[model samples]
Target: MRLSTRYLVPLIALFACSSPTTSTPAINSSAGPAGTSVSSPSSLPELAADPREPFLAKAVASLLSEDHLLQRKIDDQVSREAFPKYLEQLDGGKLFLLKEHVAALEADIDHLDDQIEAGDLVLARRGAALLAKRREVVAKVVADVLSKPFDFTKAETLETDAEKRTYAATEDELRDRWRAVLKLQVLERVEQLEELSDALAKKKPTDEDAPARPPEEIPPTFEGKEAKARKELAVRFETRFTRWKDMEPLEPAEMFLNAVASVYDPHTQYLAPAEKENFDIQISGTLEGIGAALGEEDHFIVVRELIPGGASWQQGKLEAGDLILAVAQQGEQPVDITDMPIDKVVKLIRGPKDTTVTLTVKKPDGRVETISIKRDVIKIEASYARGAVLNLGKGHEPMGYIYLPGFYGDTRGASKAPERNATDDVRKLLEVFQKRKLNGVIIDLRGNGGGLLGHARDITGLFIETGPVVQAHAADKKVEVLEDTDPGVAYNGQVVVMVDRFSASASEILAGALQDYQRAIIVGTGPTHGKGTVQALVDLDKLRANPQAASAADSLGVLKLTIQQYFRVDGESTQWRGVVPDVVLPDPASYVDSGERSLFHSIPWSSIAPQPYKVSKHSWTAAQLAEASKKRIDSQPVFKKVEAFSKALKARRDDTVVDLKRDDWVAERKRNKAELDTLDPKLSETKPRVEVTPLEESAAEKTAPKTAGDKNVKKRIDKWREELGRDPWVEESLLVLEDMKKLK
Candidate 1:
């Protein structure tokens, strides 16, 4: 798996002010026992070593000190902050060592800023040596614990949130902690095996008149299944332990530097050379794989987001929060991926197009299922600004729909012939609707995470006459106003913008501008994701001439820095508090804490004088639309079921501790599955099993030689059309459009 760089995504307008600005305190204490453990600095992680250590250090210092838009000062306060952050970066769980080890490392906490300023990392290196030693101690403990298994009924609990707990006070306490951890793992797998055994005992729904019979090769007893599960779980943990033993200095150095960058913003991060290349592949968006975004949480690779036109979404089997347990090729033995990093999981899932990959995943409800997906070129079809007609019955008015997954454009390409972009694609769709005499249009930007700023402005221009859409400002007070200069409004009879908490950056920009002018009725789950900042990728290799440094075994990586802030035309910066919609809908994401406010060191939200823009042709108060939608939701059965599921999902998310008791745990999962089943009926209707032909294209237009990619895209179009009738959110948005139509 290739490592990817983290970018600061400000989702809220947060102001940071704390920790006193001061010089380092005078200390008479010399190097402590922590520093003495490593006689020489050569013993540090191998990858952490850089022949141009001084040069790299100075280069980073110069950027943070002078070039960064934030221009954060690295004083004694910053040193104090970096101390604990770097410690967490090394060992957040406190599983490796006792309290004394942490105390020893704390002795040099006051000098980290000074060390960085001086272009020396001796203090960081000393801390790294202690961490390496602690890891070795724990590795041996894990090996011994996994050698044998027992005591499933020990009635012990393991606190999974390591950051919230204190360090082990003694070696005995640390060993006990490790034991509890292993017990929990064994209990989880035992529960899974029990479920599997029960599943095997039943006849599949498709088995026509077949008798309920277990497979001849498999074990039927509970104890036998438990033994198999335990052995495999232990082996997986052992493999992870081996990887820990292979850690190098480079890993620690990267972690430490990334921690420093995080102090400014969680998004600002250091990327290794290999990781930088991976980042480029990700930006390209055309990858041969199952089409899913993988992220690590609590050391488990979880499904983050399914690419709209990818195999995962098309399969409609996997969901966000599903824990990927193992990966297998066509006929190979399944390889457990528990505790493996996300990059490795990606490499395992990706393969040549048309190849088959099977993923064993544990659902959020604790139900384990194996998803078999054929790998293909996963492209962002929704990101292409696609159009479809939402059916509203035989006699009802035809409502047009467009799902803009992102404000995408050829930012890196020369805007040459056949330049495909979000704005252009959308304009073409609007023109198509104009010819169709559509009653209304719904622009869906539910999961749009934003893209090019230029496209956002042009997209917004398509709705309104001439007006300012967004404003960009630098720290030096340089301000630029981006506006829609054209007065030609495209198909402005009625407009509705569909958005969600995932809509961010340029998505927020376009949504905010249209809502401000009352040009469109905004209908969504809630406020947009408050990511109102811009990032510019800066290459460390290009920062200076001949930056030939002995930086580990790879070339220097790139830095994605937050360089500018974006504000809506209404004078409000969409930094922290994103754009609020006219008609709000119930969403599971709203139950969770998110947006810019959830982040640390986020830029504060402020307001400037509002820019002048033409009033919307259709004048209607939001209360009218929201009130109409509310009335509709009060009696909506699908919405009622959706609300119940949202409550259940929230409860499950907040309560991280799983019931260790097998019977109770299985019962709990059953209840969750029962609750999910009610929504499944509606969900399955939208995401059908079979492929669908587009309703808009002419017979001749639809006859193009369809590739696998084309079919994948058609699924998205078909599913959206299906959802136009089943999805309460879309139904409600269509209702909102009707209310706007009446008011106008």
Candidate 2:
């Protein structure tokens, strides 16, 4: 998780900045009007306290009430085949609550039915009153949570007594303890609520008039004015919340945590129980699916990343930013799952292997297209691999470039084959560098999301003989220094490491280790992903089966416990402090609102003990790198044009207009296209053509701008033209290599 110390300065400065002038006038004139209902912020309801008790309590109650009304309907429409393999991960506590809560509501439902049948108006009214009261309790709990936002930094000071004690423990144990707390107390509760809802839905009533119809029947379709229309449409649908609907409310921040927690460790997961079964099945390596990593970007269910060689990627039909408007199973009605949780949407898309799922996609160019894909298992062979060339420069000099996608392995069944380990691959790659008498090597770790820790250390050992690589610090304050035991430099030639934001964890470690030794010149974006902690997952199935033997809170499925946080040789924690590049380069992501710091509830930056060691300074200093970059950029045409385009792009994104009209939208799209087209003749000429129409053309048109900003488009086209001229960063890096050749 990304962490930052930038916020810490604000707290310290708050007192310094406080003054009579800084204090704004109160809403009330001279102690406010007598009986104003404006309560102080302190009087707000306590949402964090016992959230599990109330949150789950409401979910349990809702599922129970809905189940009685819709059980029969579900049993009829959805077959047993749709039922998940829930046996493996059910928590006894959660299951018990589900059973008791549903049964209690069912009893009430029966009494209501009888009263309605007998025309007992008084009794029926009384029963309705009771149900309403129960619902009020649920609503109040949710309202309390929604009233105030959560801040992760604020939570750091709110750790319980138990956490303090655990934090004082040994490194290995401390990391595990912190992870367990997050999994059990934070994630487990959310999962249980989702599972409970699905389980209780096994029984649904078929009577349409009894519960009234859901708003989805006349789905929220905004055909005008982007902002106003969405607001109005949302309000209209929300008004029908009183009635039973096959819908669940998902908090973005909470769900983001669940998705990211798993990333800390391969095995640890925090899936809402609805997705538990699907996640498990996928992990086993045999699942039918549109192999795509889906996520919500500004309320749209967007395709974040495509699994290489998957149906979508191979077809070249599905683009990374395309928004899925609708999903239609072969014989069923289309489901508009827009604004739905990612996991729930996955359920509708995935099925038995080879099943055809139709996707209605909205492309960035405002074109919509329908594509059918048969789900299949994504092969391991598809992930990037290792190989190398002996000759780097046929005429100028002998150098090599090695691309390392990531330090990956089949963790479920780690391949012992030497080819699977990145270290092994790199080792062989170095052999080529040596054999070819190369002058330098570029280790490309651009999009590598780190894998095994052992590989990180082993890879570092290949560069330097024997010294500390990275240090580990536990919450308990224990420090462990990791050293390169292999006292041999496999390839000691001038080295350059290339990275970007996607390069994280093990990638950071390798880069940091090399930088510490002054062994390589790190080149790329400002910083790598600031994920430095290691996590271990505790399988919930095993925990629940033997509750007595397991830890007190072990039944919350797999807990990806953060076991240790990494530190550089100089003692700087990489948690929030990523590996800063020696030479910063132009990155489009920086111009856009994207990066580790943009995420919610990221951890805070912290530090620990530094390893005692020093390395001889390389010939290039920070100032020299800057001077070279400036000179190279001045001479390069491509970088200058890109810089200009990036500025305009940033301005447009920052000042986005929410219009409502097809004509305006068309105009805006054309305007943007025109600007991008003018950047460079070659660049504009390279633009791809649109073959499909947008899914919601009318809706998009409503949100389009009335006046086309053709000037902006023209500028953009010119910028692209300039980009064809040259690339300064690449040129500067090449120059750096050339300089290093002189040093050797």
Q: Pick the candidate with the highest TM-score.
A: 1
- In model 2, the worst 10-residue window by lDDT is 83-92
RMSD from true fold, candidate 2 = 21.4
lDDT values for all models = 0.68, 0.48
Q: What digit string (tens of lDDT, one per residue) describes model 1 on residues 105-173? A: 676677767777777766556555566556667766766776675555544456766866788887778
TM-score of model number 2: 0.56
Best by lDDT: 1
Off by over 4 Å in 1: 1-49, 198-218, 285-287, 296-298, 321-323, 338-341, 362-369, 379-383, 411-419, 547-554, 671-682, 685-695, 698-716
Which sections of candidate 2 miss by over 4 Å?
1-244, 247-272, 277-291, 296-300, 308-323, 328-334, 347-379, 388-395, 410-419, 538-563, 614-618, 680-732
- Per-residue alpha-carbon lDDT of candidate 2 for residues 171-266, written as tens digits (9 for 90 to 100): 234333333333222222232233334433553545311112222332232221223322332333244223312321212112322322322232
